[model samples]
Target chain A: MADGPEEIGRLIGLMARLPGMGPRSARRAVLHLVKKRSQVLLPLAEAMKAVGESVRPCVACGNLATSDLCPICANPKRATGTLCVVADVADLWAMERSQAFQGRYHVLGGLLSALDAIGPDELGIPKLVARVTEEELTEIILALPATIDGQTTAHYIADALPELNVTSLAQGVPIGGELDFLDDGTISAALRARARV
Target chain B: MADGPEEIGRLIGLMARLPGMGPRSARRAVLHLVKKRSQVLLPLAEAMKAVGESVRPCVACGNLATSDLCPICANPKRATGTLCVVADVADLWAMERSQAFQGRYHVLGGLLSALDAIGPDELGIPKLVARVTEEELTEIILALPATIDGQTTAHYIADALPELNVTSLAQGVPIGGELDFLDDGTISAALRARARV
Candidate 1:
């Protein structure tokens, strides 16, 4: 039998399934929620319910949305001609947090994975191609990972859209990165892409 | 502006308030939940709503309950004459997880802390005393922490119930604790409380 009430136990079980949470941490989180029911738990429940009921993938860019288009896509002020292609919505959010990119985005959902039988179609490459002409895109920025699959997906997209100016995020040693701790691949990439101050 | 839709951003903000979760991890969790909406997000939302609406403190023991008494207090098979006193509902739940305590529990809500102005009355010591005669309790086990506040509360409870047998959890090295890693206080306590095999 589970500890506490059945409702609480079920809540804990479901919470444990969330990323970075286990049974122990889930229990702690639940206990914390119970202690602050009005301040946290109730508000959280309402938010989750609202999101679950309303949120859906944006039809144009595949980013999460409440309507047909995402906030970035709906905003007219965003530079529409330059589209940033990301492997996932999380990456899109990360880019948004940086506030460096003022353009729209196209979420690929995932990269090409031969082992998993995931191809260009699965990553919405065709949709991206269609958007190029439909949205009158000038530049397409590839914000994909440096992994093999990511590179393969990038190459395929570039090959498919020969007319568009395609570019990938520059590889370099990160800010505050120590040379001793840097990987050989990263050092080489940084050296190759070195720019003048 | 927040990342993603307003509803999704709101959900992430609330999720960040949970124990062990920060803004970054909360974002990851929200994205994960969105990905598994039917399997995790919807069910989690429903569970939180159910728990928030139905769960309340047990009138008798202060443990979380859906009714007047908690499951332990409601169950007749549990030993009636033995009552375990814990500092919080979380502590009571931890004791239940051990499956070693075969008695009902009394939640103190918190321990005595002069710094915080918490005293016996605030911890429901009077209610516990009343339960002694009402439930015909013979033994009261204190499963409080090893902190100064916990010890002070234990002593206060012991003094309040002069007639009843009041005991505390033994202090020693944990079951898997190595002596080299054990603190001086624990080592001394273990040596003082050494028992014959």
Candidate 2:
């Protein structure tokens, strides 16, 4: 028999499914939650419930939102002419965190994976093309992962949008990245894109 | 402003407070949850809500449960004569996972710590003594941690129940632990507690 009851075990099982957590860490996390039930666990549960019940994809930009349009998409002051395309909502959020891009986002949900049978339609690429003309977006900035699939997806989108200026995030050395620790591809990319001091 | 909406940010903040997770991991986890709303996120939210609403301390053993008595406490077949005393419910659960102990458990909640002002009374040492007599326990096995406070707590418990057969877990090299990787203190302890082949 397992420790605690069936519900506790179920909670652990669900928790273990999270990105970084495994069985051992999930158990420890659950134990910690049980210890601080009122302070941490209850609040987390409430927050999750609130998010789960209310949060939805923004119809215009595909970003998470409670209403029809995400806060960024709904903001009239945001750069409407420039659309930032990302593989996932996480990447969109990353861009938002940087505050470098004042434009709205277009989440592809995932990259066009041939192995996974994910095509342009599955990733809503058609919708993206439609948005370029619909929103009169002048530029489409592809802020995608530095992976083969991500590059492939970016190329496909660039080809599809012949009228619009489709660009991608710069491929170079990250700020404060150690040269010794970086891979050969990154080092070469950094050398190729070297700028004047 | 934080990534996504207020509720999304709240969820991320709450998840960041978990044992192994930091802000970065929390953001990743929240993003994953948002993406897998129907499959992983909602189910986890429901499970957490269920546990938060129902789970409480086992009055008998301090183990978490949906009822007054924990499953272990309610189980009549578990070794009633031998009560394994541990520092907390997590320790009790760890012992249960080992499957070596076919006995009941007594959770101390925490160890005696002068620095933290945690005394015997705070640890429910008196309640533990009451259970020893009430349950007619034959042997009291102190399965505390290998810390100074753990040792002090064990000593206090041993001294309190003079008439009872007080014992403790042996200090030795852990199973599957290599001697070369072990600390000097552990090596010395193993040597001191050397067993015959």
Best by DockQ: 1
- Taking the tens digit of each residue's C-alpha lDDT, what string does model 2 give over B39-137? 988898788878888998889988888999988989988889999999987888889989999888888899999999999999999999999889899
In model 1, which runs have C-alpha deviations exceeding 4 angstroms? none
Q: lDDT of each model, Cα atoms only?
A: 0.92, 0.90
Give the distance in Å from residue A60's predicted Cα in candidate 1 to where it truly belongs: 1.0
> On residues B84-186, what C-alpha lDDT tens digit does candidate 1 reach at each position?
9999888998888889999998999999998999977888788888889898988999999999999989898999999989999999999999999999999
* i-RMSD of all predictions: 1.2, 1.3
Q: What is the lDDT of residue B116 in candidate 2?
A: 99
**Per-residue alpha-carbon lDDT of candidate 2 for residues A68-114, written as tens digits (9 for 90 to 100):** 99888889899888999999888887898788999888999999999
RMSD of each: 1.7, 1.5
DockQ, each predicted model: 0.77, 0.74
Give TM per candidate: 0.95, 0.96
Candidate 2 local Cα displacement, residue A148, angstroms: 1.1
Docking quality category of candidate 2 according to DockQ thresholds? medium
